[model samples]
Target: MEQEGEVPHVLIFPFPAQGHVNSMLKLAELLSLSGLRITFLNIHRIHQKLTLHSDILSRFSRFPNFQFRTITDGLTPQNRTLGMFSDLIRRLNSITKPLLTQMLLSGELGPNPTCIILDGLFNFIVDVDAQPKIPVFSFRTISACSFWAYSFVPMLIEDGQLPIKGEEDMDRMIDGVTGMENVLRCRDLPSFCRLKDPSDPALQHGVTQTIQSLKAHSLIFNTFEDLEGPILSCLRRRCPNIYAIGPLHSLLKSRLSGEESSLGSESFNNLWEVDRSCLAETVSQMVNDVMENKRNELMGSVNETAKLAKTSVEEGGSSFRDLERMISDIRFLYRRQREAIH
Candidate 1:
């Protein structure tokens, strides 16, 4: 529990993936802007990569309330770049699970975290016994559409829509997932869903992990209402407490101004070397298509989407309001905890 007049503290734990760290770090920065204490947890390898690739340490250090901590992900340097995510998940559950238990029990990370924003992939953390009973928000790095699609993997398996039969089945329309029945095809499901056997361990593990997302007290996604309203609606039916306050990279910029607003890009957090050999040609062609082509309708669409994105993060917009509500709710959670303790 927080002491009198102490700022609310949030612990942000991201799965050791590029996308997960990028979005969660953005969220951590956003929360830091609200004068909250933020402790960002990173796996040791990813932390080293981020430090090597970016001025992340110097940049974040400017925020007095923000800090980073690293833990071993239970993988040797050799096995760290494991082939499949499911294999990594299995290792993390078996190895890192006890580490998390120790971290929480020690209370040495910081003040008892008023709230915890965990990568949705790590829903297993819910099983850890942390005495203070913190409110955990499952933050998914993917779009609302992807998360919604993932939630229905079990149904897809049961309906015989998965174990996607052959090349012919690639174009097969999928009706197992509600709200996306018409829009989704077999080929559109995530790559892991293309397995030849329904009983594949990897496939089953993915379903189990995605299903476990529901166990979180709330869900946070890096998307805005304008982008995925219908799918967000479907998601809300299952997880009533959700915050779709994102395009976090953009939203953070919209909420800040001047040099203080300077934040790192996705590449800054990337673990692997980026290939820029063909960048010049790619940009040249893209610029030609957008600006020079007489028949290009893409420019108009791009402009329209950009305008919508800007509006969504400005005052009185859906994302801006959602972000405020999310912050307020987290503060409320802290208050409720304090009240219960007293």
Candidate 2:
């Protein structure tokens, strides 16, 4: 039914979490705009949630070439709950490999995917590399600073500074991370990195698995160059193929026509309930006077830095240039595949 020399197809697998899924979806939209056929995959549970929203489903149905697919997460309909579902995620990660492989080899889904772009969190997917011909790229949905922090886990372990063992040492601070100037207290790092019990295997297992997966492929981080110059420079030296294409929402808004881009206006990645207790207490009259009197200087400096970073990612900025280059690369790959098949 179709002719030869069609666009190269891409399969995108976002880590089942909300942030990862939202970031990857933005990239998928950019790829689709470049004339590539995209098959966006999600865990079955997440897919069901999206489908339930009638407005979202209606918008999704309009993208004919950009299709949605799902693989079982090994989760039952009743298992969904509040807070971090670590056990369920671990089980889902383990089961994804075989299901993904089956989908790739089925042939029923059209030509095998030209490439598989996976979320950094789902490092287990990298293990399914039996089909080596299909290139895989890791999409890390975090700041370069955050990724750089993660990369130090092994060294921290070697130094006995991490994998916090017991209640007695919960307040320890870690020193000598490359980009961060201030000494980081244990609480400042991601919650998973602060596990106190040595018997708890998930924290260590996740760190090890993510590090091993990074070795398998090139990485694309959702951070712009100017915003993360120090960390991005360090990462580029360590991993040559790393691409810093981010603040992706801003980039997409600039490119797409007003109406087309608005589809993602309300899209957000926070699945957890908001905890505003700290803010509420801080704003109360008693604390407000004490805090405001102490130092307005520190607060102003932070705001200034944020504003500077925001301006640098606008049109003609570093992120815009990298995005252009990325689009060019995708177009070139599609052309080459078309030539080969013809």
Candidate 3:
């Protein structure tokens, strides 16, 4: 337990993938800026790749409470690809689970985390140390629609929705997913769900992980209430404690800009170098098409949505307020844990 006045410390463990690490790292930076202590855990290879490719180290160097730690994933870089994801998960459960347990119980990492912001992809295991009762908040890097659809995989299979007969059935409605019945189609389900076999390992693994997400104390999404209101409503029926305080990257900019906090240029933690060569021509052609051919058809809806997005992340917006609530809730947990100990 932390001393009476010590700041709340949060440990962030993102799945060692580019998209997962990128979003969670932004959240980590956001929390550290808000005066919370943060310990970001990464696999050895991802950490090295991040350090070598991005200014991730110097970016968070100003925050004394921010730290980075790593453990082995038991795989070489050549072995870590989309095809080997199942092997990676198995290895993490077998090899990395012990190290994580030790870090929690032995205090080898620093202060015991007031809470853990975990990657939803690794929801297969939630047994962090049981003694102290650490709260875990599952963060899914994907959109709520995508996660909601994944959660219904088992239901879809039981209802004979899987083994989608043929390309002829591609446009068939996917009624199994609650709020998205009208919008979701067989072709729209994730690529893995398109397989001829319903019992495919990857598909089953996805279903298991998504179903296990409900085991977390709460769920966090990288979206805003205004954007996914119906889907969010469906999710709340299952897990009520959810924080939709995103588009995180934009919200972070809004918060920092409002506070007049001058954090340097935006930094990206991509595992591979970004190729910008085609962007110039792409942007010029896009602008030309939008101005000439798409003007009447697209301008109104585009402008309206852009305006909503702007308002959603500004002061008192749904996302901004939810972010404040999330921070407050973490501190509340810290105080409650301390009181229980006393």
Candidate 4:
């Protein structure tokens, strides 16, 4: 437990997938640095992978205000079994939601949790959000374009753009979704949307997550406006309170200290083994290019991404202020709750 007057506490739960965990972990660190107390919840199986493949536990200890908690993912060691994994995900939400609710109501996580930042992918968390006095905000770690594509599943159905007839319809343009008339095709839509059977569970799950996001107090995306401005505009209809502060790697790199943070980021997304061979290949290419007096294509492209990321985090930037605003809102919630209790 923290001291009575500690910074407002937050509980963060990420989907156990490697990519999801990595982005949310960075967001947790950012919130912690901004003077919030953050408790990051990890599933037992994923945490074990971090222990074996990365430095997650040791890396987080340096933050005075951040800590971790774990619960079972309801799966065995092999997360590869899709049928088993899908069943486990359903059980996880039903099982973990109540457990998390119990933890919060007991004040075991801290004095009072002002907010719960959850991965937007889970349907069950919204039910947890209904518990009195605690709010859940969703953080969607997907690109805004993909989210916008997913958001239109219903519209597609209405326009007969979905339930694609066959492979022949795959290449047809989806004219139903406004703002994407020329840009989006059936094949370009999210993979789940490609399923000919509209009743497929996987397809439904993806749709549910996108729709469920609307119920969250706020919806945050790990993308910046310059990159996905049009799709983000479309998303605002469903989620008015949206924040796009991403290329999260850039945001973290800009604000954090040095190598320690970088190293932690390495395993943050690599639940699988990394191909360090890319490094060897790149260095070799650079040497060859220099001898031939030719432009280095890979290095040039990387530098471009780095440049864009850096530009997005400058003073008075979208990501910087949105992060500050999120922390402030949580503190405001904390104060209001305290006064109400008295």
Which candidate has the highest lDDT of all? 3
lDDT of each: 0.80, 0.69, 0.84, 0.76
* Best-fitting candidate, scored by TM-score: 3
Candidate 2, residues 50-100: lDDT per residue as tens digits? 665324455555566778888877766577664446666666657767777
lDDT of 4 by residue, 211-271 (tens): 8887788889998876777888888887787888887777877776455645434435456
Candidate 3 lDDT tens digits, 1-342: 344348898889999888999999989988887889899999998998999888888888998888999988888778977789889988988889877887788998798789989899996544844634888999999899999988888888889888577666688888867777689998887888877787787787888778778767889999988788889889999998999988888877776664543464566787777677778888888897768966766888777766777788898998888888999999999888879889
TM-score for each of the candidates:
0.90, 0.80, 0.91, 0.86
Q: How does candidate 3 score on lDDT?
A: 0.84
Higher-lDDT candidate of 1 and 3: 3
Judge candidate 2 against the unseen true structure and give its global Cα lDDT, from 0 to 1.
0.69
Looking at model 3, the pairs that clash are none
Off by over 4 Å in 4: 1-4, 78-80, 83-85, 126-130, 257-269, 273-279, 282-306
Query: How well does candidate 3 score on lDDT at residue 8?
Result: 92
Question: How high a TM-score does candidate 2 get?
Answer: 0.80
Ranking by lDDT: 3, 1, 4, 2
What ranges in model 2 sit over 4 Å off?
1-5, 82-86, 126-128, 165-173, 196-199, 257-312, 335-342
Write down the TM-score for model 3: 0.91
Kindly report which residue pairs in candidate 1 clash with one another: none
